[model samples]
Target chain A: MNFDEIYSSKLALVEDALKKLMERHKECPPTLFKAMNYSLFAGGKRIRPVLLLSAHELVGGNVEESMALACGLEMIHTYSLIHDDLPAMDDDDLRRGMPTNHKVFGEGMAILAGDALLNLAYEVFLENAMKYPYKLERHVRAAFVIARAAGLHGMIGGQVADLEQEGKDVQPDMLYYIHTHKTGALIEAAVRAGAILEPIEGDVEDAVAKYGQKLGLAFQIVDDILDVTGDAASMGKNPSRDEARKKPLFQLCMAWGNRGVWHGT
Target chain B: MNFDEIYSSKLALVEDALKKLMERHKECPPTLFKAMNYSLFAGGKRIRPVLLLSAHELVGGNVEESMALACGLEMIHTYSLIHDDLPAMDDDDLRRGMPTNHKVFGEGMAILAGDALLNLAYEVFLENAMKYPYKLERHVRAAFVIARAAGLHGMIGGQVADLEQEGKDVQPDMLYYIHTHKTGALIEAAVRAGAILEPIEGDVEDAVAKYGQKLGLAFQIVDDILDVTGDAASMGKNPSRDEARKKPLFQLCMAWGNRGVWHGT
Candidate 1:
């Protein structure tokens, strides 16, 4: 399939998976589950899980094997986003063209939603492991990859660095480290996870991982570019908020020296 | 060995393991490493890791294997404590006897320290998996146990519930759920992980898990009791802070309705 078609197809699968997952949580407290589903169902690119699925496909892995893994990655990504938007974190009021989780659900409920999502992510992964017909080795490897990506060395590490650099002129090396670990780590794990499941070896796994790494960084850079140039409506939130906060984006742009990059917003 | 002597010896071993882990981070920024070590070294009971080691001994598992697992558990625990004390989370000024991480280090550094410790925990586990002379299955199973305990279903779930109930009167069932999931999950995992490594089953494993569950709950309840009656200096922090903040503890105690019962602090 062409890129657009492929992306659309992958997203459809993700939407279906998410629908099933959210439905499972309905037996939980109604308001709490609704708030959880609100941010989860809120639109995003589903890039990490898609990367996982696509990489699995490329490696001749069964889509069945990847389905839960994809969903788990998305759960984690979504949870992080929810937490990141908390008043204690990014304090964003809008995301993906709608109110942020805390904005709609209140901070307390939003926090629970994020917590439930994080918990459910692992539960889903464990459930997948129990169901998968594969050897225990593959499941273990997958767990390690997912954990590393989600934990400090990968996404959380990046977040820590990113938070540290807030409102400061960060070095280029620090910026790269932040982006690679924080954003790229999860993306890389998505691709690598697929490869691991399929038992791909040698250069193929490495190549896919590299692709993910590059794409993740490119994605962040595009976000930066968009924050500078894209319309608030198109971007789904306030475009100038990052600038107003004097976040590291300004330092990154200055390092790139890209003035007048946007003619219109 | 008696419990006191064994505890002291295990503490020494844990200290060594923590020292080695901190040494690995020396190449990173000193401020970041120092903050990470500060929390790691800050004296807590080391209950989770100690339980793991004791369970391993009870099962006749290798001490080295148990030690590795214990170290990993401690790292996860320490990191969670650091994050838990953040201005956005509990906003505590003290943990154990020392200033909370964010108080000594800025909020940003404290955040990164937690992140780094979390990553290092996983790294240590991965290394153990690689080095184990036993079958990969055992290591993988152990790793899964740790991940499950540390991840959303375990500690993170409890944290979310605790945060959700902040400034609210929580029912006994809700309080039980929070404390069990938060504190009990990891403790149970510690015991179970040691058993998993040794390849035991039947009532033995179940008994160990049950013991851990009860012990974990008992520990938390005792902590609650301490907060109400313990000396601040002896406890190493403000014991009454929980009550002052109108946290869920008072509600929990009232729900239990054991005002006459006293567990020695």
Candidate 2:
């Protein structure tokens, strides 16, 4: 299959898994679930989960085996988006042509919904990990990479720095850290996490992670470039929103596209 | 050692672990870490970690083996408090005579700090679990219990229900579900987590968990009773605060304590 066909098929697998898992948990409070589901099911490309499955496939792992984890990644992404849109954060009202979680449910329930989604992400990962004790070590490692990548050292760290640097002069290194970390870390981890599903050698793992990193960096730069070039109606988000905020997002892209996507020599 | 001495020693171990772990993450932003540490280091009895250690000991597990997980539990509890005291949540300013996380840091930072703590807790758990793969199936199980207990079906679930019921008539079943889930689930998980550290049988695990459930319920009742009867100067916060909120908190205690802590036969 071509890239679109392959991506769509993998995306279907992730969606099916997420739907079944969520449906199983009927006990989750209705209103809170509504808020969480609102964000979670809001249509997106599911790039992270698809990337994870592709990486898993690249390293000779089954999509079925990684289905729960793939869905879990989407949930974490959704939760981050929900929190990021809160009044204290980006304060956006519309997401993907729909009202954001906070907008529909109120900020309080939105926060709870994000919390629930995060907790459920781990639950999904752990539940999947529990089924395969013989490979418990790898599953634990995978979960760690995902959580750590989305964690303070990775996403949250970048967020803190960005929030701190708001309306201030941001240095190149700090700005680089913000985009690569805030956006790219988890993307890198998703690919690396998929690659590490099976027992791979150290050099191979390093190479795969490096590749993932380059891919992640490229993805972010393209995202920024899209913001400059893509139409608002199609992109669903306003074009040049980041540049409009007066941050030098394009410098990093120019630096990368001019030099190769990967940083190391 | 008496209970105090033993408790203090274990408490010291948890504190040291937490300190070392936090210190190891020096890369975390200063402001964000400051907010997290403000709440984490604020003086309160380390009851959760202590219970974990005691339970681990009761199940013949070494403290060193469980130290990381023990500290992880406290991190989760600390994160809960930070979020709980947010302006949108419980809105408490002073916790243990010091400013709450949001009171010290702005609301945005406090939220991030709580997110960081919760993420860190799982990271700590997985890091410790990674050290010994042979016992990982059980470690995965233990982590699942903690996550599940603190998750939407447990603590978060309870918190959501409580928030929804605010300024409304709270039925006894709803009240019971709130306390048992909001407070008791994690408390019970702490005990069960320690019990499973060494891989005990099903019946033993059940009995230990029962003991934990009883202990947790008793603790909450006594906490409510103390609010009605205890001195404010010693309690460090105002008594009857829950009552002042116009909730029949003590009534549940009176109904339970006057009868029995556990409702299930």
In candidate 1, list every pair of residues with a backbone clash. Answer: none
Please list the residue runs of candidate 2 whose C-alpha ends up more than 4 Å from where it truly belongs after superposition. Answer: A226-232, A238-250, A254-264, B226-233, B237-250, B254-264
TM-score of 1: 0.83
Question: In angstroms, how far off is B254's CA in candidate 2?
Answer: 5.4
Cα RMSDs, all models: 5.4, 2.4
Model 1, position B55: C-alpha lDDT score: 85
lDDT of 1: 0.73
Q: How does each model score on lDDT?
A: 0.73, 0.81
Q: TM-score of chain B only, all predictions?
A: 0.90, 0.92
